[model samples]
Target chain A: MEFIQQVINGLAQGGIYSLIAIGWTTVYGVVGVMNWTHGEVYMLGAFCGFFLFTRLHLPFLAGLLISMVAGSLIAMAIDQFGYKPLRKIGMPRMAGFITALGLSTLLRYSSTALFTPDPQAYPANLLSYKLLTLFHINGKAITVSSLHLMIFLGTLVIMAALELFIRKTLTGKAMLAASQDMSTLELMGANPEKLIKITFAISGALGAAAGVFVGTIYAINTMMGSLAGLKGWSVAILGGVGNMTGSMLGGLLLGIAESLTAGFVSTGYKDAIGFIIMILVLLVKPTGLKGYSAEEKV
Target chain B: MLEVNDLHVYYGNIHALKGLSLHVAEGEIVSLIGANGAGKTTLLTAIMNQVPRAQGSVSFLGRPTAGMTTPMIVRSGMTMVPEGRRIFPRCSVLDNLLLGAYARKDKKSVRRDLEDIFTSYPRLAERRRQIAGTLSGGEQQMLSISRALMSRPRLMLLDEPSMGLSPIIVEQVFATIKTINEGGTTVLLVEQNANQALRVSHRGYVMETGEVVLEDSSANLMQNAQVKEAYLGS
Candidate 1:
């Protein structure tokens, strides 16, 4: 019963991790940049949600929508100002990586200075904290919070919509092709730059949604992005870098592992569990769970 | 028609194309034959504005394409079947074909053209749902060519379409190139297979070290002594 309870507890947090990892992988796959600032984008989104809820008193759904739009704009601005110039000058790959790191630092500190380093909480009544009882295993009832159910279901809907978009839409298919070869996409008469911007925008929206979810569950702080961003990268690596499905699965696995560690083992070791599994998975498969070896370019 | 005049392209310090000049008239199969590192690929990319031109001017259909982006060039009715068949390996064959028509806005004609392609190449139609990477090299080449054709290009640039194909497949590919030309799409073919390229082309240019060493009617170029000894292996 306790194990089942722990699993249930981990799922909502896992959903948030999945969103962040998907954002990271999508940016890496399409733009070929690590996008270290993504976590900061998530932080900014959390702050956006905070402002919307506390100041404007907008409803939760409206806050989520506004946060997502804000996240996309911020991400697109990062690409436009931070990375696009590097691309135009035909800079090396390392230059882009360094730029991402620098931008991440700048954004993190700027937010820290702007919002102050203190943690802020979402409204206690912003979401109903009603716990629904499922079944009694022994004498103890297994229960889930309504918020947790909402977060998990919301992630499922978003992922399903994303999958459908990739499969059914021309622009989405073009994005898939761009991941394969950007130059050839240009040969097909699709502007790769436009596709790249859209990719960043989508990635930003996902990250922001995850941020808002996390903010609702926990206190929001400028420092929150640092750890969350690293965990997201770890999830991306665990799932197989650049593979969307892998990131999704990896995020859930890490979340469950962490929750179980906290339940059965030391809670102090919960954060270490994800990285240890990632290292082990790398040692075994190198390509993560679903990552295929890159085919030699013909 | 495509016109390249004194086009100079550099890869960092390496002078890939040094003030080279070439042109393809409308309704003609013009072949540019060269050895490896002789700037054949650079010339094609430069024509499409994929590479920075150090000094040059490319005029397509009598308009200067000085600052046009590659996709803009493609949208203006020219596309390339790039070297080594750079098809989206993970995508389905049908998706690949659909992406080839990405820039086209006329949905009805695009659908009709897709049907036309399927009718012409039953093999592609058969494997439309299959992942492209699983296809044979010959099928991949065909898909690449068909992908270029999907753009409804007035001029098609082919870069070494026979690079890794078997001799029989190469022959079939050349035949398809001829068929495409007969269908009224002008072709700018770059090949190391000089003999076969000359056979299929209306005119041929021999490139050496980033400059045009010879240009003439295909029959005369085929009969030239230096061309016979250097490229034909006769």
Candidate 2:
């Protein structure tokens, strides 16, 4: 019963991680740049939702919608101002890495300045938590909350839609190809710049959605972005740097592992367990489970 | 028509293309033949704007191609089948073909071109659903050419289409290039296979260490003593 209970507890957290992980993976896959500010995007999004819902008295869905749009625009603006000029001059790749770190620092500290260093909670009555009993094992009932179900379902639907888009749509297919070989994609007449911007937009939107989840289930604080962003990048690496499906699964795996560690062992070991498992996975399968095989391209 | 005047390309300080000049008139099959590392691939890449030009001008159809992006170059009806048949390995054959038309806005004509390509290369039609990486070398080359054709290009740049293929496959590839040229698309081919290239092309330019050393009609170049001794293995 404890095991089943831990699994239920892990799913929503896993859902949020996967949303954040998608942001990291998609940007890395397309631009080959580590978006250190990714978690900040999520943090900003959560704050956006928090403000919209709390101050403006908007509906929950409306708040989410605003976050998605605002997050996407913010990400695109970063690309435009920060990376586009560098790309124009054929910037060395290390410069991009530094740019990401610099951007992350700037966003985090500025956000702290804007929102203050205190944690902000969602409205207590924002979401009604209806409990549902799954089944009784050994006279212990396994229960799930409405909020948890919403996160899980939302993650499932979003991931499914993303997968379909990549496989079926022309622009999505082009981005997948661009991820493989941007130069060849250029010869095929797809603009790498446009595709990358689109990638950032999608990634920021996912991060924003994850931000809303974290803000709702836990609490929003200025300090949340840096550590959460680091974890998101780790999840991306643990899955496979460029594989979207692997990141989703990796997120779930990390979530369950952390929950189990916190439940069965000590809360102190929870974060440590995720890194240990990721290192073990890397040791065994460096490419991650569903990673692209480095087969001959020609 | 394409004209590249006094082109210079540099790989760091290596200076891969040194004052190279070449041209391809409309409806002509032109081949650039050279030894390995003789700047043949670099020239094609420069024309497509893949590499920064140190000094040069590439004019296609009377317009300067200097500032155009590769996709913009393709949209203007000039496309290249890059060396080693750089097909999108994970994409389906159909998807590869669709992407070839990425710059063009004519959806109806693009679909019509797809059918024409399928009818022309039945092998490609059979494997249209298969991942491009799984195709055999010859089939992959064919798919590459077909994909370039889907752009409805007035001129196609083919780089080493015969690389790693058996002689039989090479013959078929050259035959297809010839046929495509006959069907009215101008061809600018780069090849190390001097014999086949000179035989198929209407004209040929011989390059040695980043410079075009010889240029003439293919028939005359085929019989030239220097060409026969150095390239044709007389």
Candidate 3:
């Protein structure tokens, strides 16, 4: 029963990490930019959700939608007005990296300055306290919280939708084309710049949703994004950078490992679990679990 | 129809193309055969608007195309299958073909074109769901050609289609190019494989150091002494 409960908790937590991992991988895949500000985007998403809920007096679902859209727009603006011009100049790749790091710092400090440092909590009693028992044995029962259930189902739906979007849609095909070869993508009559803007938008939206979920589970804090962002990067590397499905699997696996480690092992080592998993994956398979070997362009 | 006049292109301090000019009439298979470093690829890139040109006038379908975006150039009924097999490797063969119609908005026409491309390249139909990157070199080249055909272009620019493919594949690829041209799509081909290119082309130009050194029918260039020695290895 305790094991079942732990598994449920792990699944819920994995849902949040998977969203962030998706955000990281999407931008990396399309733009070839390691957007460090992605974490700040997630943090800002939670802030957006909080602001809407308290200031606008909107419902939780409405707040979530607003956060997703707003976060996506903000990230697109950054990519277009901020990063695209730099790219036009044929700027060095290192410059883009530095620019991303700078943008991350700028977003973090700006968000902190705008929002209060004190933690903000979502309204209480809005989410139900109902629990459903999945199995019972030896007079002990295994139960799942409605919140956890929502998290699990919502993550699966979103992930499935994203997979379908990338695989089936015209715009998604363009994105995949751009990711593989931007120059060739242009040859196919696609505007690679537009694809990149869309990538950032999608990545930001996913991060924002993760932020909202975190705020719902825990509380919104200004600094929560940095730590979460680092964990998300770890998840990306673990699953293989630029591989979408790999990131999701990596995030879930990391989540379960962390939860189980904290539960049965040492709670103090929970923070170190992500990096440890990354190192292990790197040592075993450098291309990640599903990453293909990069071929040289002729 | 495509007309390039006095085109000048530069990469930083290096002058890649210097006062190059050529013309390809409707339904004509024109070949630009040149030695390495002769700016063949640059000419194609400049015409496709992929590379920035310092000074040039490209008239496509009898209209000036200066300062146009790549997609805009493509939308004007011209598309390029870039140098090397630059197929989107991670995507499936079907996705690659579908993306070639990226600029087209007519869904019914797009579907028809897709069906036509699959018919032309039946191997693609068999492996439509397979990732392009996993495909063999010959198959990737075929995908590249099939993908370009999906765009439904009036003019197709093929840059070195025979590059890096087996001799057997090259023969098949040239045969396919002939078939594509026979099907009414004008082709402007650039290649270092001068023999194969000239054999398939109607008219040919010999480019050297970004300048057109000679222009004639494919047979005349094949018999030209300089071309025979420098490019055809005869």
Candidate 4:
């Protein structure tokens, strides 16, 4: 019963990880560059949502929508000004990674300076906090909250929509092509610059949405992005760096594993569970659960 | 319909193309044959506007494309099937072909052209949903050609399509090149397979150390003694 309850809680939290992991994975897939400040983007999004809710008195849903739009624009700006020029100059891959890391630190520090490095709680009543009993396992009862249910469902919808878009749309097809070989994709008449820009925008929007969800559920803070970003990175590695579905599964699995370990074992070791599983997965199957074959001919 | 005059492309300090010149008339298959380091690939890349040309003019359909980008050159109806069959490995065969028509706005016509590609290469149609990287070398070559064709080009540049295929597959690929030419697409075919390329091409140019050492009708060049001794291995 305890395990089942832990699973439910983990699934809810894991759903947030899934959204973030997907964002990271998508950008990595198309741009082949880690947007280091991605977590900061997430932090900025929550702050954006919080400002709208508190100052402008916008509805929670409206605030989320606005955050996504703002996040996407922010992401586009980073790609256009930050990364694109570097790529045009034929910079090494490591340079892009380093730039991303530098950007991430810069965003985090700037947010800390602006937001005072403290957690800010949003106004309550944006979501119902009513607890619902899912079922009972042993003599103990298994319970869940409406907020958890909403978060999980929202994640599923977004992932499903993204999957459909990639599989069905021409632009999505182009994105997949770009991931494999950008120069070849360009030779085929696709504008890699345009596709890369859109990829960053979508990744940013997803990160923002994850932030907004966290704000409504927990509290908003600049430092929150670092923790969430670390979790998102773990989720990406756990699922397979370039694989979308893998990240989603990895997120859920990591969440449940952490929750169970915290509930059954020591609470101090909650963070250890994710890294432990990640190390084990790397040792056993280096590609993660759904990573594709990487034996591409050079 | 494609002409490159006095082309000179530099890769940093290395002069990759040193005063290279070539032409492919409409509905013709012209081959640029040379050994490794002879600048065959660089010439095509320079003509496609992928590599910067220091001194030259690339005229396609009587319009100058000397300083245009690769995508712009492609959009202008001249596409290159670059060396090494650089297909998008993770993409499906169908998506690879669809991206070939990326610059065009005619959605319905693009779909129709995709079907036409399927008709041209039935093997590609069979593996339409399979990832392109998993395909055999010959099939990948066919996909590269089909992808170039999807752009609906007046002039097609193929950079060593038969570089690493089985002899039978190479024969099939060269045959298909002939058929593609017969279907009204002009070709600028580059190859180290001098005998086979010279057999199918209307005119041929022999390159040595980034310079055009010889240019003549395919029949005349094939019969040339030095061409046979060095390239054809007679």
Candidate 5:
């Protein structure tokens, strides 16, 4: 019963990790940029949700949608102002990496100045904190909170929709092709720059959704993005850099590992669990669970 | 019809194409034959606006292509099958073909053209659901050509289509090039296989050190002593 309870407790957090990991991986796969600002996007998203829910009193779903849209806009703006000009000048890859690191630092500190370093909590009544029982093992009820159920279901729905979009839509297939060979995609008469923009937008939206979810479950602060962003990167690496499915599974696995560690081992080591697993995976598989060897592009 | 006049392309300090001039008349197979690094690939990429042109103009079907992006150039009815058969190896064969028609708004005709491609190359139809990377070298070359055709190009640029294929497959590829030209698509072929290229082409340009050293009817070029000594390996 305790093991089942720990698994249930881990799932919602796992789903959030999956969202963050997916956003990070998508941007890396298509745009070929390590967007360090993704966590900042998530932080902004939580703030977006905070403002909408606390000030405007918007419904939960509406807040999530608005946050996602705002996140995408923020991500697109970053690409436009930060990365696009560098690409146009044919800047070296290191230039882009440094630019990303600089942008991330700039966003983090600015937001810290703007929102202050203090942590703010969402309203306690944001969602009914009811624990619903599933079944009993030896008379101890296995219960899950309504918020956890919502987050888990929401993540599943988003992932499924994403899978269908990637498989069935032309734009999605073009994205896959762009990841493989951007120049050749241009030969097919698809603007790779436009695809890059779309990729950033999608990644930002996913990050923001994750931000909003985290804000609901825990306190939100301007400094939250730093650690969350690092965790997201760890998840991306753990999932196998550019592979989407790998990121998803990696997120879930990390979430569960963290939860179990916190439950049985030690809460002090919960955060370290993800990084340790990442190192182990790198030492062993190196490609994560679902990652395949990338074919050489000529 | 396509035209490039006084074209120059530079890779940083290396002048890849130096004031070269060429044209492909409508319904003609024009071959540009040269050794490696003689700017064949550079010239093709320059024509498509993928690489910057330091000097010169490229006009296709009577309009200047300067300032247009590569996709825009492709949308204007010119496409290149780049060197080494750069197919999206992870995508299914059917998905690869559909991506070829990405710029077209005529969905019905795109489907018809896809069917036409499948009929002409039944091997592609048989393996439409398979990942493209798993295809044999000859089939990949065929898919590459078919992918270029999907854009419904008025002028198609082919770079080294026979680079790593078997001799029999090379003959079949040349035969397909002939059939494609007969069906009314203008072709600009870049190849190291000078003998077969000249045989299949209506006109041939021999490039040396980023300049067109000779241009003439393929029959006359085939008979030229210098061409025989340098390129044809006779």
Candidate 6:
């Protein structure tokens, strides 16, 4: 019952991790570049949500939507100006990864400079705090707040919609094929540049939405992105580097593991639990659980 | 119709396609046959704009495609069944086929053409739901060809379609290539399998280390003593 309670507590945060993991997984999948600044993008998104709702007096949902739009544009600009030029020069992929790391640092420090490194809170008066009693497990009434329900349900809805888009639409299927072999996808008449833009856009939008969800739940700060981004990438690696299904599972697993560790063991060890499980899984299977077979004919 | 004139493509300091030239007329099965490293693939990649050409002109339907990108070239109605049958191994067969038509605007007609493709390759229809990588090499090749065909291209470029296939499957692939040509899609195929490539193609260009050493009717080339010694075997 405590385990179940821990799982419930983890679900909201787990959903957030999985949402972020999908973003990191996608950008890596399409162009095979890790957008290192992905965490900063998440942070900026939180800031975007923070300002849009709190400053502009917009509704929470509306601010989240605008943040997605803004996040997507920001990511597209990063690709257009930063990575696309590197591609044109025919630089090695390692160069792109390095550039991304540099960009991550740039974005993080810039946000800190701009936002003054001060933590900000979402205005609580916007929404009333309401809790729902789910059930009584071992005489302890297990309950979830409206915000907790929102995060889990929101993540599920987004994921389900994304799955349907990938499975049912031509552009979506092209994304899957592009991830496998981008040149081949291009040779087949699909513009990889366009698909790449869409990939980053989708990734950024999710990151921003996750950002807003977090802001609503807890205070937001510039430093928050580092841990969130680390968790997202950890989840992505834990599931599989480029595998969508693996990333999702990896996020939930990390969340629950962290929660359970904090609940049963030392709270100080919660942060270490994710890395430990990732290492253990890597030892057992080099590819994450849902990762595809890496077969190349020489 | 497609034309490549005085083509020169380089991989760093190495000149892969050195002053090579070839042309394929409408409704012709043109094969570029050579040994490995003879620049057969490089010539095709240059034509498809996948590789940058140091100096040359590649025109499709009389439009100069110099500096054009792959998707742009493909959108202009030329698609390549690239070397290694680079099928989306993780994708389903149907999805792979659909990706071929990613640029087409005629949404309703795409459905009709898809049915047409399934009719031509019944084996593909049988495995439409199966993951592409799980299929045999020959099926993957078929999917690669069909995937290119889904674009409804005016011209198709196939690179080494028979490399690593069984003799019987090679026969089927060549026959399919012939059928594709007969159905009104011109073909510019690059292959190291000189004999079969020559047999199936209407005209053959023999490349010897980045130059077209011979260009003649396939039957004529098959009879050439030099060709017989170097490729066909006595």
- Model 3 per-residue lDDT tens digits across residues B1-234: 799999999998989999999999999999998888999999998998888888879999899888789988888889988888888888899898899888888989989988887887888889999999899998999899888888888999999999998899999999999999999999999998999999999999999998999999999999999899999998
lDDT of 2 by residue, A122-205 (tens): 887777788989889999999999888887888888788888999888898888888778898898788899999999999988
- Which sections of candidate 6 miss by over 4 Å? A295-298
Q: How would you encode candidate 6's per-residue C-alpha lDDT over A1-298 as one tens digit per residue?
A: 8888888888888888998999999998887787887898889999999998878999877998999899899889889988999877874778998999888888988888999898999999655578888999678888877788887888888888888988999888988887888888889878888899999999999898889889988999998888889889989988888878888888888888988999999899999999999889988988787876663211
Candidate 3, A232-269: lDDT as tens digits: 99898888887889989988888888888888888899
What tier of docking accuracy does candidate 4 attain? medium
Residue-level error in angstroms, candidate 3, position A83 = 0.9
Question: In candidate 1, how many Å is residue B88 off?
Answer: 0.5
**Model 2 misplaced regions, further than 4 Å:** A294-298
Write out the backbone clash pairs for model 2: none
Report the C-alpha lDDT of model 4 over A42-68, residue by residue, as the tens digit: 999899999988889898789989999
Instruction: Give the Cα-based TM-score of candidate 5 against the true structure.
Output: 0.97
Q: Model 5 misses residue A265 by how many Å?
A: 1.0
Quick one: best lDDT, which candidate?
Answer: 1
- Better candidate number, 1 or 2, judged by DockQ: 1
Better of 2 and 4 by DockQ: 2
- Candidate 1 at A226: error in angstroms? 0.5
Error in Å for residue B32 of model 5: 0.8
Model 4 lDDT at residue B43: 87
Q: Where's the lowest-lDDT run of ten residues in candidate 5 chain B?
A: B177-186
Candidate 5 residue pairs in clash (backbone atoms < 3 Å) = none
Lowest summed lDDT over 10 consecutive residues: which window, candidate 4 chain B? B44-53
B12-124: candidate 4 lDDT, tens digit per residue = 89988888877788999999899999999888877877777799788999899966777887888888898999888778899888888888899999999999889878999
The DockQ scores of all candidates, in the order shown, are 0.89, 0.79, 0.86, 0.75, 0.91, 0.89
**Model 1, stretches more than 4 Å misplaced?**
A135-140, A295-298
lDDT of 1: 0.93
Give the whole-model CA lDDT for all candidates, comma-separated.
0.93, 0.90, 0.87, 0.86, 0.91, 0.89
- Lowest-sum lDDT 10-residue window in model 3 chain A: A289-298
Model 1, TM vs. native: 0.97
